[model samples]
Target: MSKATKTIHAAMAAHVSSALDALQAAGTLPEGIERGNVTVEPTRDPAHGDLATNAAMVLAKPAKTNPRALAESLAEELRKVDAIDSVEIAGPGFINLRLSDNAWRDELRAIAALGETYGRSTVGEGTRVNVEYVSANPTGPMHMGHCRGAVVGDALAGLLEFAGHDVTREYYVNDAGSQVDTLARSAHLRYREAHGQDIGDIPEGYYPGEYLKPVGEAARERFGDTYLEATESEWLPVFRGFAVERMIELIKADLALLGIEHDLFASEAELQAAGKPEAAEAWLREHDLVYDGELEAPKGKTLDDWEPVELPLFRATRFGDDQDRPIRKSDGSWTYFGADLAYHFQKAENADALIDIWGADHSGTVKRIKAAVAALTEGSGRNVPFDVKLVQMVQLLRDGEPVKMSKRSGQFVTLADVVREVGKDVVRFTMLTRKPDAQMEFDFAKVVEASKDNPVFYVQYAHARIASTLRKATAAGVAPSADGLDRLGEEELALVKVAAQFPRIVESAAAAREPHRIAFYLQDLAAAFHAFWNLGNDRPEMRILVEDDAEITSARLFLAERIGQVVRNGLAILGVEAVDEL
Candidate 1:
């Protein structure tokens, strides 16, 4: 555990136990109130004070006392604790506690001691977690829509690892799908063009992008027109395999452009190797989750091509889904959901927890997937749980005008294009500035702006500022070491206290599977550091490296160096760049 986390936990345990004792003494509580429910979190509104608790409101009904009365009594008890500078009962029986300045100052010293490891935690306790994301079909280049899931999943994995979870980043390859067949046909058209044949307007259903020309040329070089005159059935598999392999290579390159590397690349084709869909079918049958049924046409919209058909279906409604879903088509081919269910089952066998990051358009699929897992793990009694995080769309804009993108026209913005335009650091940091479930707008102009509005720049600037302070200290023949961190002033001390909260932030972000929390925390930390820096301009003593006092300069430099280390560490977790000299 990081030093910041240890201090926060100790502070919480001490304060909570004291409050329970006071409640017991006043006889205003039940025989045993679950103190485990009490929590200390930094309040969103800083005016409410440092940390606030809703413990009084939560315990009031159980104690049969007015919430305000309970809060008042709790406040009186908290005031006696040396760690608490003051305690106040706010609206609706909330207890807000302000810690003494020394508490904040001491946190700075702890941050200096811990350095880059300041915000890390052991909350996950080495639980194996698999995060599967960006499983885009290998038909063509990845469009802008695929960017959010890739960034969120990667960031979430980083957050989990920092919080001490054994996390595996995975990418599921959809090479067995019909999309790859379409890609083969598309490549065939390109091959015809390479052979000087008039391929015409890119046959109706095939891809029309010029990106496939290389694949075609490579196919021609390897096959030497041998398969050119062959039937579709004889040559389709050959072309499909070649095209999918090349597409995967292209996808890997795109991912590398954005600094993402998956620990596992699971293939859908592997699930049904050698003409056997047994893995998925057997798992579904073992749980009695599969049955023959007819699916109703989708509601709210009527499809002219809709036809009622009976087939093998997963009894998803038995759990919590709205209706049963098909696992096999009438033609005996496995449905998309069937392959996914089996893939998740295979994933469950390898990891303690499963997390799939998907696009928002797949929201309707969440319930059935969870239902399948619950059914599969019914009697064996192992906790084989799964979580699906849906990342909402990112609308790209340039100067407030929406950037046009159309996949059909092959005119959509590619992930590689965005990364090249804004650079990986800006792309990643901006992508995570908003919560996963919230729709985000990526403004190209604002992302590159060198102002506070650009969180990436602001955070980087804070790190750079701290580095400058250290450089100034070193030039004056003073070495800032952990031993001298005790001499930090109020402003320096406040920055340190904020830095000490990193481990707690990591723990919270990992537990919630919300990496945006880390981004938000970093921005706030930067704001605090910037505020302190501005204060230094007004008060010479507040400057991190004071010229007159060697001891004071060394202490301030120690705190500043720690701040820079923490900024780098936090940025690293978000897969963002921390510029030492912005």
Candidate 2:
């Protein structure tokens, strides 16, 4: 936790303890009031006071005393505390405490002492967490929609790790599906082209991207004309394996372009290898969650050949699914849901928490997956917690014009394309400027603009401005050490106080799985720093690196340096660059 949070907690505890003592002495309360229920939080309205508590209002009825009387009594008791400068009883007997400037000034010292480690926490207690994200089908390159999930998942994992979780970043490879078969066909066409064959038009229902030409050529080089004479059974597996491997390699390169690295690459095919599907089916059967049934037709999509046919189905409805879902097709091949169940079962054995970062398209699949987990665990779901975060789509634009993306035409803008165009730092920061559930608009032109309107540039500028101040301080012979911080002015003290809140911000954002909160907090911090910087222009005495006074200059420099460190640390967690001289 940050120094501000610690101070808040400590001060609030003392105040509450004193109030309890007063109540006990007056014999106006029950034997044991839960002091833990009392909380101290920054008042939403700054005019109200620095900190506000509803403790008296909460304890009034139970203590058989009027809330105002109790608040007055608590106020009298809290006035004895050293940290609080004054106390007032507000509306409904709410207690508002105004703290001494020193209490706020001490935050700067705490921030300087902790440095970059100021915001780090141990709340997660080392629980193992598996974060699976961007499990995009390896059929083609990643697009704008994929960027949001990648950034959110990566930031969340970083946040959790900072909060003391044993996080494992994973990518689930969907290699066993029919989409890969299309990829193989596409690669086969490319292979024919590579072999000097006029494989004119990309076949219908096959991938048509020019990217596969190289994979096709590689395949031809590995197996020349051999697959031409082979039967479908003999060549499909070979071609599928080759295509899948090449696609995975390309996907990895694309992810690297965005600075994403996965510790685990789980394969759906591997889950079904050596008759694992049958084993999974058997396990379900033993648990009585599987049976032969006919599924209802989907509500929206039309199925012309739909017929009532008995097939293997999971009793998903029993565990909260909307209806029983098919586990096997009419041809007896495992359905996608069946494969997914087996995959999740495998995951349950390895992780204490399963966090799947999926695009909004898969929102409907969430409930059934949860139901399957419940079925697989047979009511012992405590060992595995499933959290599915649906990342909304990103609408890309340039100069107010939509960047049309069509997957069928193989002309969709890829993640690598965006990174190359705008740089990874810009891409990562812009992707997180909004909440994950909200649709985001990524305007190529606006993101690169070096203005306050662009959040990335704004935050980076704050850090750079601090660097400029530090340089100015050193040039002016101001000692950049903590020993001189005792002379810090109110402006410098305010900046320090803001910096001290970073630890608390980190803890709250990590606990909420809201990395966007970090971005918001950084923006606020930057705004505070900028406001202070502008004050220097208006009042020379407010400048951080004051000249002709060694002690005051040193104190100001320490505060400026601490602000830069905090900006860098917060940006690092969000995977954004902290340019020292931008």
Candidate 3:
């Protein structure tokens, strides 16, 4: 295999697979055992080896043989590979493989050659994936809750693209629901307020956010009270459209502050107006997936009327949900879920797989939407995967105190506020420092800290240090070259091994839909570089700018440059800028 084709890990996996084939051909192993399930990944404790494989443990049962016996055979065969320094069969049936120090040195050269595209892979094979995220309602500006999903979705899209997937970053604009209607009413009040009516106390059920005050001002400026005197019916439609359009702008601007932009804005109102909801209803009714039924009063919630009514319902229970979900209310207006089902059905027509990054508050609805997709695909005899990633909330803090926010009272901190406080790079990187499903606290004081505890600062500082070293080296009449790179010491080689995990890290994180892995991986890489840099504190011979031996200095400089390149590439996936200077 060539370096241009795949990473070192892929090459190793292929070689081991071929060894298995050779064993089967020589009648030492079974001829037809599944090999795709074989996993060759890094070990947590580096003391074991650089990489470990469960080939024997996985294949033993299928091949009907003793695992240890097969491991001994596999270990014998793997030793013949060129990159393998030694192979040790560890506890149970895991085979640990250590690569030569020269292999680590060569990976540094590969990083230098590949630059920004170092860890990119063809694993996705051009599968068209739609990643819908930050689908905050188009009623007001994005608040603290929207920040995590925004960064996670954007980073996941970039990660998938790096893995060679055709990804579409999308946002589902909920402009058709009752919320938008309420938004229109709120804007009408704002319009009145803009006209000097002194609209006091903003009625009880309407939005009270000051962000809508601008929409009112814009409407007053544009329409000039043309429909202010008109009846509610005449002005409702006009104001609804105007408010949604303005709210879209507000949402987009908030997203732009965090360096996020969507490839498509899917509108629920458009889907309904285009008769898609009706079409979906007709299709479900034809397949008996929908029916007119009276539902039991919903459990775990208190209702005033508590009366059963006949409604059009989707057969959610048939697809493993607890109960059938209603598509339309008794009054014949479409429910929110009805419009959403139609929207998803429309999205499925364009992509092979679909992903939605939603807040954890919507956790209960995940199963129903999944069942809906399953029924839709099964009914149509087409397999399209739909996955929902529930992002837990982030607790905003200041000086170790919780930043309490409420959308109703408009006391919440906006995304723009946080970004303005500590730059877009800090906001994006800090939001992605944890998994999407895990709740994390974002302390304003901690993120901007210059210490190693702040991951963004630490990684950026490492890159800056490397850049400063290289610039000073260049100024002193020394340049980097491939010559004498293998003469590096143990500390340099250890950093090389840690940096080489970038390729595998990208592939794994992309597959798992987790971008936090990149942030953590960069932290580890930065830690390794910092540790290696500290090696020069007491030992002057290990420093990068040695005056007597130019060859050794050039080799060390070349390695440092590639380390910076890896950090830059990793930061790119997270949508964070890699600063050349702290």
Return whichever of 1 and 3 wins on lDDT. Answer: 3
Predicted candidate 2 versus true structure: per-residue lDDT over 1-582, tens digit per residue: 543545444446566776778778788667787665676776777677677888898888878889998888888888887778889889889998877766766666666666767677787899888899999888877777788999999989988888788999999999888888888778877877888888887777888887888898899889999986677778888999898888889988998988888999988877778576787789888878899887776676457766678999898889788789888889988998888888887777777888888888889999999888877765544558788888899888999899986777788888888899999989998888998889889999999999998999999999998888777776766667767655665666667656656776787787777888889889989999899889978888777766656777677677777788889889888888798787
Ranking by lDDT: 3, 1, 2
Models 1 onward score TM values of 0.88, 0.90, 0.96
**Worst lDDT 10-window in candidate 1:** 1-10
Once fitted onto the true fold, the runs of candidate 1 whose alpha carbons sit more than 4 angstroms away are 1-5, 9-11, 14-35, 43-49, 52-98, 195-198, 274-279, 297-307, 481-489
Candidate closest to the true structure, highest lDDT: 3
Better of 2 and 3 by lDDT: 3
lDDT scores in order: 0.82, 0.81, 0.89
Residue-level lDDT tens digits of model 1 in 15-74: 767777877977867777666677777777767778888889888887888999988888
Please provide, for model 3 over 314-376, each residue's C-alpha lDDT reduced to its tens digit, 9 standing for 90 to 100.
999998999999999788989878888888888888899999999999999999999888878
